[model samples]
Target: RARSRGRRCSVTGTPLLLCCYLAYLALGTSVFQALESSAARDSKEGSKSDNWTSLLNYTCLDRQALDRLIRDIIQRYKSGVIFLSNTTSMGRWELAGSFFFSISTITTIGYGNLSPQTMGARLFCIFFALLGIPLNLVLLNRLGRLMLFWVQRWALWLGGAQKNQARARWYAGSFALFSGLLLFFLLPPILFSSMEGWSYEEGFYYSFITLSTVGFGDYVIGMDPGRRYPVWYKNLVSMWILFGMAWLALIINLVISLLESSIVLCPCSRRNPCRT
Candidate 1:
């Protein structure tokens, strides 16, 4: 047989990864669509079939009966015992929610403030995560390595033509760290502040929390009531978050590589791995 061009799985991984992702995308879209559709139907059904409507229409009911009916309905509405929506407001599992949930799951940020309330969605979330997390890890690791290669070349070039190698390397590390912060942190907050109508501080906090994957579950995007945004707006926000996570991975990988190199170069490293 002719010599193989590369590793046995080199050709296989790309197609396998593509297939896995497509399957997840198709399956997840179908499942979440179904779940959200059912929820919408239920909410509409409740709104259509509210008990108060019959009570208000019935002529035979006395004042006491009407008062009791109003009291019960008011209590239900206040306690979240009923969920009603007008034409403008979408249900919890509408398109925006579906997009948000998908991003949150893959990122493992799990912003606890919003989740699928239905059993089908809960079960799906569990298994989908089981399968998707590995795919995420592998892809992120590969991307991190690719980014690290470029970062090292840039750093080496920047720090070159120096008399002291160690000082040059240190300078390079500092450059990478500063650039990563500026790219991943400082710039995005400005756009976010304007788009989300948040103050600069809140925008920065949200950006930092999201990229770090801390996901305290406090702040989220596109929550403005009675405001209509274009379809591309929310979709773009989701894409931005995913891109930021990839960039964050690159930063972490760069830092780790720098640390390892520093340890190797340290005068004491030849004697002990942990000793300073």
Candidate 2:
């Protein structure tokens, strides 16, 4: 992999890039099973009281919506499937269990366990989401592209045909638009409605509103004891929202690439010229 990676970079001596490559190679597959087991334990111990302390709580799910979330959590817990969490728990074992979970939540993979609870934390999340989201996407893209270049000896392998830099960018943008719709519009409603027992429209509306950071508190995550997940769940939801934002940034980049390509492909006007 190191030799393969070296051939991909045009630069002969950039140590930082090499370090990133090394990190990617090192961290790619650490502890999938452990994360799942720990999350399951947290779910089994979940409670009505813990909702407000979530790292990822939002105001859209309301009581009924929250109840549905709780059911899914409990169901998953009972089924003994592994989920993700980033919360610090009681013991050293539990604290250590949160190691990978914290990494995922902070980076926004948001397997859905640990999250923020207080208003101050949520407010901090808004800032963190904006800044951290782009960082994650850029890093993910670089890491992904590096891996592709290493293994395939090409920029893009199977996803699509490689084009000029501009065309490649446009292709990426299309992916962005598609993903954005799925994340911002489609997935939220499906997840919310299922968890909160909300109407699909209401779920979507809340998704849109909360994602936009409007925070119309007409509906909220923990208002219903019957519906809310444990504190861990809400915290994870916050992490998910941030991850959603990072995905959104990828979409934006894709859109910009597409527009740039379209302009390049078209005949030039007086105002804009295609640079050779």
Candidate 3:
């Protein structure tokens, strides 16, 4: 009877948890829009004013001509022609870029910087992703478990057998989280900042966003056409992204385990299995 009642409570609580999650998302959306919308509007207006002033000062073109020029540039940019540089011989559809795109697609980190334009290519992409995404997920799951095993071993070495199993697990989780932050979040940003000419903070933000698979497309690497990059650059970045994502997955799993264990140990949970 008790087990059946507990099961019922657990089933009922799921909807309540889902409602709370939706409400949290709503709160975040509202706060972000309120904070950013005004600044975005102001920036847009300022940009228009600056463009007009630059056109008037530096060129003989009138407003109508400027508008036409802007339209033409936009058209070319949308067609992916303007992305090619006169000085650079590299094209977006090259092998290295395609490899990077494939990795990004399978990892669900579609940066929206590059995409297939042809119908056939798009169809292929859909089929490729259908298979590759699951394969990538399976690989990451195994890698996460391997990483967790190593983390536990390190924890045991550090804390020794005198520590309780729970304490050892906590130590392992903490160590994994800190190590991942340092390797994926902190150290990589320094290199990115130097290589990309971005500020440290921007590099850190990009690392976090990319590893989280948000892929906002604001700060993609190796997209600049004016400057030449090494041929291996994109491949190296793809490798970094793969490892960082796996590390992040491991950290997330550790966090979820910790949360579940904490809930199981809660005093209210002992009295009511579905109290959460």
Candidate 4:
């Protein structure tokens, strides 16, 4: 009974943890939106102030007068003076933005494009990552097993190896290798390049670097100055990063699993060659 309970908990752990993460994500989105919106408004007001200040210079007003006015306006908004709003609430820290940050933290990607500016947020991130990393590891392993199970089942049916365990394993492993390469590595570059207007080489390079978690912070999506993307579009990119990390984890674990099982000869057998 205890073993059965253990199995049940293990099976339920992934979804339960996922639900909590999503709930936390929802709360973060609401709070950050309010914070970012206020910041943007203040920034817009600051720019209007700056433009007015510039007019003083054109009219040859006293240098001291321009300096005093600018200082007073900046001191009023405080840190909003630095946010530099793009006239849109398209902050680098929105719902999808926070979601991406959460995913990157859990996956150990650490893109560093966006980070917590406040001390409280930084401390919270530290604790969140401490717990979230282990949960992410467990979830990735479970996902790998689940996906492998279905892939192997398909392979067995296709190869007519339903009754043959060894043949099924071989066929499934081979098919999985091919499919994993196509789905994770090859197709993504092409798809990303088309959607983000990146060169094919740049797309492939970004995909490789991101999945490997090197996170150089060179290329980013939806950051075009001339073009603004929809909210759903940004969210979709975050979803892609999450799923791509899962697939990468699955492939790495699958390879490790294979290596561990590959050594067919036991230590006892190796020492008793005369028995063979």
TM-score of each: 0.56, 0.36, 0.82, 0.58
- Model 1 residue runs over 4 Å out of place are 1-91, 156-172, 230-235, 250-270, 274-276
Give me the runs in candidate 4 sitting further than 4 Å from their true place: 1-91, 159-168, 254-276
Best by lDDT: 3
Name the lDDT of candidate 2: 0.54
What are the per-residue Cα lDDT tens digits for candidate 2 across 222-255?
3343554456655656655565554555555668
- Measured by TM-score, how close is model 3 to the native structure? 0.82
Model 3, span 37-70: residue lDDT tens: 9999898898779867887778788888978987
Angstrom error of the Cα, residue 238, model 3: value is: 2.2
Q: For model 4, where is the 10-residue window of minimal lDDT?
A: 267-276
Where does the lowest 10-residue lDDT sum fall in candidate 3?
A: 260-269
Give the lDDT ranking, best first.
3, 4, 1, 2
Among these predictions, the greatest TM-score belongs to 3
Name the regions of candidate 2 deviating beyond 4 angstroms.
1-155, 159-172, 228-232, 249-276
Per-residue CA lDDT of model 4 for 207-256, tens digit only, reads 87887777776776665556667777667666666666767877666686
lDDT of 1 by residue, 1-276 (tens): 112422333343446556767988999999999989999988878866785466667757766787787788877654434345542222245666676776678788776545766689889999988988788778777766766677777667766766566777777767766776787678777877777677888888998888777888778776565456567767676766766777787767668667544533332323343321
lDDT of each: 0.68, 0.54, 0.77, 0.70
**TM accuracy, model 4:** 0.58
Model 1 is weakest, by summed lDDT over 10 consecutive residues, at 1-10
